[model samples]
Target: MNFRIISALVMRYLFLYSRSPMRLVELAFWPVVDLVVWGNVTVFIQKNTNPEFGSYVLFFLGGMILWDIMFRAQQGVAISFLEDVWTRNLLNIFVAPVRSSEYISATFIVGMLRILITAVVLSFISWFGYAFNVFQLSWWLIPFFLNLMLFGWSLGMISTALILRWGLAAESLAWAIPFFFQPVVAVFYRVEDMPAWSRPIAWCFPPTYIFEGMRDVMKSGTMNWDYLGYAAGLNILYLALAGWLFVWVLNLTRKRGLLTKFATQ
Candidate 1:
């Protein structure tokens, strides 16, 4: 946990993005696209549905905002690691004084920074474009946002560990793995909307509880501590497991002398 090393690593990544216009656009691309597509759909539904059905824009926009948090958080770490692999720099990094913990710490910080940028930008668009303010949902927004970020970070760790062990063949997991949970997360729909057979699997994801609670608050104007509590507890467990798995995989890679293979391939 050397702060100097962590700062250096963070600066390195910042410099990479700062120099590349395409990379900066990529950070905002998917999120803005998701908001526009879903925002319009939400508006259309509101006009067509019975007024009794109530406004759905909040739910739709809220889900999209939170889901992107998870996406950006996961990509922030997993892709940062992949950048090292793509540039053949992993060996150079590890051969230096940088420890695994320090590297992860720096990536986590950068990921959070990305989340903040995305959150603020999306929040503005949802407000002006759709007349939906996520902040109005509740004060509980803070905890729910944090819970989703942690879950994303845990998933990123697992993805990185898999890539480290199997090489670039598994690099697709960095982008593909997060979407695997999207169906189960029930982001735009309730858990009940999931097939009965898949309900249990959906519940296994912590975001399911957060979204469920989000819907509860939207409908009743009250927060459900139970859902937030469940999300927090599950995040702690998953994050610990992810951390352990990453260290285990890194050790195996070193034992087999595969860092060169990971870096060069």
Candidate 2:
């Protein structure tokens, strides 16, 4: 892929965000809100449940902080894609010199940057206010975070595909899709803790393994790279399928003479 094309596309978003103070605020605002609200709730629960289980609060708070990283990664792609959709610029973007590969790369690059910024902000809040430090995960943090990022990108691509296929009717998914996986992904509980019927669905997601590994680390104070491997494997599969689905939907939309008229629909 041409770096220039990717750079241009990425810069467009960076410039857009730079110009608007509210856009900058919006980037980190909701996450801070989530951290604050959930952080307090977890603390309250810890206080009530048992003071001896001090890690209980961090369990919930840490889960939430890590969860938001994936969420922000997804929003980076889905919401950035939506900006083009909302402005009726999808056609313009496609007709330009940019290739599909370059565009997708740009989205991922942009998404990665957005998530990193959000992660830094959340880390500070988590560290200072909650007395929780994500860095404590050490080397294990890399694989889990990377897998989650891949999963988030895959989901975002699928969401973009659906919106391209179904128009504004499917727009709500950009904001809502990640939440759909929250319960099933074992963010706060182990996959086995879920019902038998739901466990099948849970395993299909990479975050399920990552969280399982995460919980194991919390409970045992040891690294379990096996779960990270599972997560990485699932992420590879998820990413392949997501890219194929997006291209397939894009082709179908084009064949149906939908791209030119997608914005109106």
* Top model number, TM-score: 1
Which RMSD values do the candidates have, in order? 1.2, 1.4
Q: After superposition, how far is residue 214 of candidate 2 from its true place, in Å?
A: 1.4
lDDT of candidate 2 over 130-198, digit per residue (tens): 777888877778887898899999989989999989988899999999999999998987777799999
lDDT (0 to 1) per candidate: 0.89, 0.85
Off by over 4 Å in 2: 263-265
Q: What would the TM-scores of all predictions be?
A: 0.96, 0.95
Model 1 weakest 10-residue run by lDDT: 49-58
